[model samples]
Target: MLSIENSKKRVTIHDVAAAAGVSISTASKALNNTGRVGIETRERVKRVSVEIGFRPNALARGLLSKRSFTIGLLTNDTYGRFTLPLMAGVAEALVDHGVSVFLCAIEDDPAMGQIHVEAMLDKQVDGIIATGKRIDRSLPVDLSNLPVPVVYAFTEGRADSVSFRSDDGQGAKLAVEWLSRIGRRRIVHLTGPEAFFSVRERAAAYSAATAHKEPVLYGVWSESWGHEAVARIWSAPGEKPDALFCGNDQIARGAVDALREHGIKVPEEVSVVGFDNWEIVAAQTRPPLTTVDMELKELGRQAGLTVLALAEGRPVEPGVRKLPCRLVVRQSCGGQPSEK
Candidate 1:
């Protein structure tokens, strides 16, 4: 039971122990959810602590535990397109455990990357999560043998390191299969350069889904390419494709605009689906774009947890973790309604 203590004074573990009629060590174990304490005693101790407004000092706890309870996020993605959502996920996963995340954007500068890495190490960060704009590329500075645990998210990682990335093939298959379910045939793939690893993976999936009936149109990841590709397809001597699957939301927006200009009714005539469900492009399109969401936030959540586990001296398997994708339905695909 909670005793009548001075409300103005800072309540420490001793106060909680006295209020709950338990020893200091038992109170500590109960509060931290460690050691073998009876359920009733643990509950009583926690209840008394809350009732007495007891708050643990984070600095003192860290010093005693020999852990900073902080993580560093190192990224080259200055645009924050992917990093923002991923950071949100990491923060969400770690906040409950009193963990703070420090974000450092190195922007492809090796010197700056090294400087930021050194600063994080100086601050005694428990772990680091390396992320980037693309999955096939690594950050400029090497993080091979740091003193802390390193986890990779949406970036190239070492062969033995644990990494997390969205499954491009799965995302492509989701888009293609959604179009197929809506009775779209002769689907043409308008995507970015074939040199990109993601482009190749998506193209392979598209080919397998479509049975190689149509060739993929590879170009830059731009709206102009999408527009020009549409013009070229419409001007061809063969039958027009009933649907178009773009590599990204920007391309999908361009395709939709071009179709509108060419007097082709969207969905009614040619359904369109895009990848990377980028809201800026997907949500503002004429009829709104139905795209594949890579679930980067969930990937970040998993990466954060993995790094935390490593920091806590827990075992984790070293390999690439591929998260599945989900299709966001919208008017562009003539779907029932918009669903993310």
Candidate 2:
């Protein structure tokens, strides 16, 4: 592993000049792409700098150029839970390109928009990335009018804002297909709290994927929601479902616990599948879980890159860029591929 401390030794224009056999000012122009330098020499200087592991001091360079070289991140509390990994992916990508990130979580009213925006502007952030999942209702309409370019992740901005969307519909279809492959026709759905676009897309996918057989849908994203859904299922007087598809692993875990209390056998009497391959919760369950991995980190990275492009005045695709989701099969869903 290359130690950052080892890599942090300053590599100045003088060093690049000495290495590239060019004058100091010529080295500066080539490395910063400022002033004017021959294209061939510029490329040679840049290549040699990379070879020697030269990293310019981001702050001093920004001061000279008058660009902050930083992006401000705004998100809800789950930013760490759902947004952090994506942020990590985004940060990794940005670091290579020499950008720094400033992050803050907004949990209250009048603060998400007014307060956070004021702070970022005060610091002169070059761009802004806001995570939309679990967004508090207080973000003002005028928040989009920030002086710098602003991007939203796991969330959308209003009016001419470019955003990235998760492929939940596709994820739902994959989940349903997995269940169908196991010969589980009567699949039930557990959903997240009402009216989220993600829940709606998943429901639509469920409807589409099971259109041939008409599977059932129910439940929300939380363990409590799963508990309530199971109680309802237990109380209803009808033929029991063969499988339960949950909105996320949290609900599936809760449902699994409740099923045991009701003497139901998982993957035997009932099979279960869920969304979001939440490892901590997914890995620790009694029978483990078969769930869809939405690749939130990739999603965040995509959103970050998109926003950076827009900020840089580069053209980006107008419609949503859907991130990929993978299905992770485990013991909870009977370990049997659906055939119907």
Candidate 3:
């Protein structure tokens, strides 16, 4: 037996065949389940191949199967906070299909995006999944005329392209309705920049749910903005909001800290709900945050499956698909105590 580690030798089909005590042709047929071969013999060959650490060459398999079995993921999110989860989802969704993904971070540079796209095209990727930091924004390159199928995930797409994104309105409604059910009437909406598409969508949902008693507070998507928003709302000293619905977790965390500084008990004095159930930020809060989860990973999985379907010539309905979001219950909303 070849000592694969000591000899630094690549295990081949020939080695597998020899280990299985069969001819190369017979071994190939048995391993591939092609031609005529006894089931017992096929199982033996497979077991021997595994034992000998035989790995078939992907390029050779592609040549025979007429597919590279590779896909490209284009993104401008260098930080990878959003990209990593989406990529993991895509990988999980395509695991059964035996497909691999190539991630390209263009960093919002048009030239860089084109270079990555061309490189992937040269490698003959089966399809491309274009994603970005913002759902309303497009990647820096053009995928309109690629030879392969392209799907948009959390990124803007051309008119006819199939795209998947979070349902911002539904997620906001879940948070607002939950607060309302818990008897929170004086609700205030604090969110990010008004120019952002998601902010508008969420604000609209909050207003509709609350009947627009107080105006929506639009500011930066940051902890500082959240801190300042609380100050501004309390400065007038009218009827204080009993509940605050923030656009994202960062803002909610800031609000919680500010409330504590002002001697207010969370959920006891003022309930808070945030969007984007980012565990890193949400779980670290004092009482933890009750936030709406956009289910980004699920969005990526659906995008991956849709792209693969397009690549395989399967009929996939074109147009934007908004996936549903769910509420993640935590202590911030005066819910039951969580298990430690």
Highest lDDT among the candidates is held by which one?
A: 1
Q: How many residue pairs clash in each candidate?
A: 0, 13, 0
User: For model 2, how does the per-residue alpha-carbon lDDT over 40-95 read when each residue is reduced to its tens digit?
Assistant: 99999999899887877766777777677678877764437867787897797688
| RMSD of candidates 1 onward, in order | 5.2, 5.4, 3.1
Report the Cα lDDT for candidate 3: 0.91
When sorted by TM-score, best at the front, the candidate numbers are 3, 1, 2
Tens-digit per-residue lDDT, 115-177, candidate 1: 999999888899999999888999999898999999999999999999999999999999999
Please give the RMSD of candidate 2 to the true structure.
5.4
Poorly placed runs, candidate 3 (over 4 Å)? 1-7, 15-25, 38-48, 337-340
TM-score to true structure, per model: 0.87, 0.79, 0.92
CA lDDT of every candidate: 0.93, 0.77, 0.91
In TM-score terms, which candidate is top? 3
**Could you tell me the TM-score of candidate 1?**
0.87
Give the Å error, residue 318, model 1.
Answer: 1.1
Order of candidate numbers by lDDT, starting with the best? 1, 3, 2
Worst 10 residues of 1 by lDDT: 331-340
